[model samples]
Target: MKNILRTAGVLAVASASVLTGVTAAQAAPSCSTARVCLYDDYWFTGTPRSFGWVTYNVGVDSNDKGSSLVIGPATDPASPYVYFYVDNNFAGNNVVFRAGNASNDLRGLYMTPTRNWDDEITSVWG
Candidate 1:
């Protein structure tokens, strides 16, 4: 009985550790080089949206639906940052996201009364 209990305890600890690790990994964001990724929810959770090289007026689908984003290292040396706007047609409050800098959560960067930009982005460019 004593040996059996010890084995069960070890298995329980191992399982807990594995679960914890998975949760931590899911809470972080991973960005690919030369691309921009936006997460619908903070801490890199929820829907993942990607963008490429272009001057864009974020379409209706992704409009006002970004909570956090990742700006990968600029593959083009001349363009080292991405500019985002709070309104359509690149109008309203704007923010710059430099290459090699990003966040898992937007609450620190973009915020509202509730969740950071829960659904309030309109345009982007790099």
Candidate 2:
């Protein structure tokens, strides 16, 4: 009887853990509805250069706000490398960049309002 009780307890704990994981996963935001804009070979002029604008509706929930910018490789022929930005903030360098190869040229953008921004950013980058 004691062995059966122990096994039942273990099963209950395992089930609880699995359910918790599934619930957390379900709560996570998805980028399926994310709006993406792409541009090619553009030059920078000044601070806050407009890459593009995103205007969401009342019902749409955005995980973050930013655009992905691509720049040509230094020597490789891979067309361009990807950079990210969030709220106009650069992801990799933590410094803003221009459209081309400016000092702060942003390869991409990603901005999240939640306290879990760091985790979300890390996940996105990875």
Candidate 3:
């Protein structure tokens, strides 16, 4: 009886470990095929601005400084059609925009070498 109980416990633990690994793997996002598209104009000013895109698999930190867009596998970071900004006018001086549950889209729209620009994000598409 004692041996049987120990074997059952080991099997239970092994099953749980396998299940947890599967869950974690499923939770991770794949950006291999994801792409983002961005428009060149802002809603308020309608001014044509040139913006670039970069792909980041790791999550964005709130304290980090720079103008960048965060995207997921379904949404390509290379093409950000929407313009989101983190400017100096906001309370925390940080802006985070979420598009879907599969991946979180972060836009550092207002980050400039000299200062931050508080502006509205025009549009976003995957």
Q: Which number leads on TM-score?
A: 1
- Report residue 111 deviation for candidate 2 (angstroms): 8.0
TM-score of 3: 0.20
- Per-model TM-score, in order, reads 0.66, 0.20, 0.20
Predicted structure 2, TM vs. truth: 0.20
Report the poorest 10 consecutive residues by lDDT, candidate 3. Answer: 39-48
Worst 10 residues of 1 by lDDT: 109-118
Put down candidate 1 lDDT per residue, 8-120, tens digits, no spaces: 98888778768876444554465777777888887676788887634456677788888777887788878898887778666787778887776666666654445455566
Which ranges of candidate 3 are over 4 A from the true structure?
1-44, 55-92, 99-126
The lDDT values for all models are 0.72, 0.29, 0.34
lDDT of 2 by residue, 1-126 (tens): 999999998888778769875433223121112212222222222212122212221111222322222222223233223233333233332222222332212233233232322212111110
Error of 3 at 75 (Å): 3.3
Candidate with more favorable, higher lDDT: 2 or 3: 3
Say which prediction, candidate 1 or candidate 3, comes out ahead on TM-score: 1
- Residue pairs with backbone overlap in model 1: 64-119
